[model samples]
Target: MSPPTITENFVDFDIPQAGKPCKTWYTIYGDLGTSKYPPLVVLHGGPGMPCNYLKPYGQLASKSLIPVVLYDSIGCGNSTLLPEKRGDGTFFNIDLHMNELDNLLKGLGIEDEFNLLGHSYGALLGAWYAATRKPQGLRRLILQSGPASLPLWDEAQMDLRYQLPKELQDILDQHEASNTTDSPEYKEVVAEFTRRHVCRIEPAPKELQETFDAAARDPTVVLTMYGDHEFETNGTLRGWSSINELDKINIPTLIMNGRYDTAQDKVMKPFFDRIPRVRWIQFSESSHTAHLEIERERVMEVVIEFLTEDV
Candidate 1:
């Protein structure tokens, strides 16, 4: 009946490229030191997106007594921002973010025992970390509406784009071909696609909108790591894939996506097919942000169940 205990702080992070000091902002719901369960470290999407939209998931702390950890990836949210790093692909690559996550874990003193739940781009990062780092303490993995690889992700988006109305399809093609994705026309068409596949909820939740606004205000991370186009990749992550390394992810895994997600079943299938231990669930009535938009309660139930069940 009472509000969950919340703690906010900054972890000093040193970035070699910046040649200066940096910090990662993090918040914890529930008492990590006192809780019996390992903390659930949440990774948000957007390679650049802040952690605002994912804040709802903090309920696990209050509801189930599981500590929930949320932090803005460096260059996003309350963490250090690098507007000057815009278009600097060499500096904004995945490894930088991964290292930041690693630092946060050690700084929080839970790197040894923790669960991971990643959404969209965050999912991709989670998969990579589990597969490559093979952290011995990682207990469970949740990949929420995330693709296994960028190429497969882009392919699925192209397939979805073709299914759109011809008029809208033509508009996207014309704008993309002209490299005018910044145009209002292109953005409008993109918004149409986003409404259908990204977040079907009319007038998205305030937290979701905050993430979008943060990305728009400083798109350095998305623009440099992902790219301007929604359906394609022209940035540093062009051919990224973790298919071969998936088998290394020895922990129990749960993969989820909406029926209408841009991360179509095809893109998520590789994770299910390759991971040694995994479960897949698709929300029939949801899109990309199933947890925040339409199926919040169900999503929480499924995640909580997975996190608590003895394996």
Candidate 2:
């Protein structure tokens, strides 16, 4: 049977990147709904991780009576890649990303409006958008498996690193000291770590696995943004935590995480405590990717209720 999602094609437009603007493309999953129903704009994680895991969210089009838009940032996924800004582009910074999103919304005719559903790094992106840009049209914000602070991410990954077998930990330790993460042995270790807590579904779903495979082939962007392995953040993203400063967000927010997620130290506590209007829901089976971890019915129930329920 065909999936019930309604897909909308897009054309490229000049979106800013590294101080200069570049062409970028975006896709929208439109459903039978009106402007009264906010278009949920999805921001994917990984400074470079495409909006792939979010592909399952297309299911929202079929299930919910609303519009959902999915787009890749400047140089990742289906968006245009700017090799000119390859390493030193300001595009990697959060402020630039926020602005890019702003411009995209305006160009695409959704500016200052629409709901935000950010996962992983995208959650931080959403938090920044809400706190800093303060888009006037946002109705409710949904953050899944997001860390309020970069330090929280660091702390969580540090723990995940230790969870590995002593022997595996030794390999990782050696790689860190030698900067040999590209070694075949290291790839094996990375796979082992992912199998444990990244996703509970054995072999993972095809859509989810395709995303992982894409990362494996050209991980430069992911590594450049998140660093080697999913356990640590010693890359350029160091010192970028937000938990302590999350109080700036003055909007309705939904925080989600999986029981086995790498998000650490009662991860949702600070978000709920600091953000006056917030709700936290734990997905029993999902770690980082709740949308795909559990059954479709279970996943959409929370989404429908949260997105459509009386606020």
Local distance difference test, per candidate?
Answer: 0.90, 0.73
- Itemize residue pairs with steric clashes in candidate 2: 148-242, 148-243, 149-241, 149-242, 149-243, 150-241
lDDT of 1 by residue, 74-191 (tens): 8888888998998988898778878988899999999889999999999999999999988888999999988799999999999999999999999988987888878999889888
lDDT per residue for candidate 2 within 1-311, as digits (tens), equals: 34555555544455433445455556677652453577888898887777777887776766765678887786677676655554553456787678778877776777656789898888888987887777887888988877787777777777887988899999988986898988999878887777666777777878677766666655656666676555667566777766656787887898888877877545556777887789988877677776877655676788778988773
Candidate 1 worst ten-residue window by lDDT: 226-235
State which candidate has the highest TM-score.
1
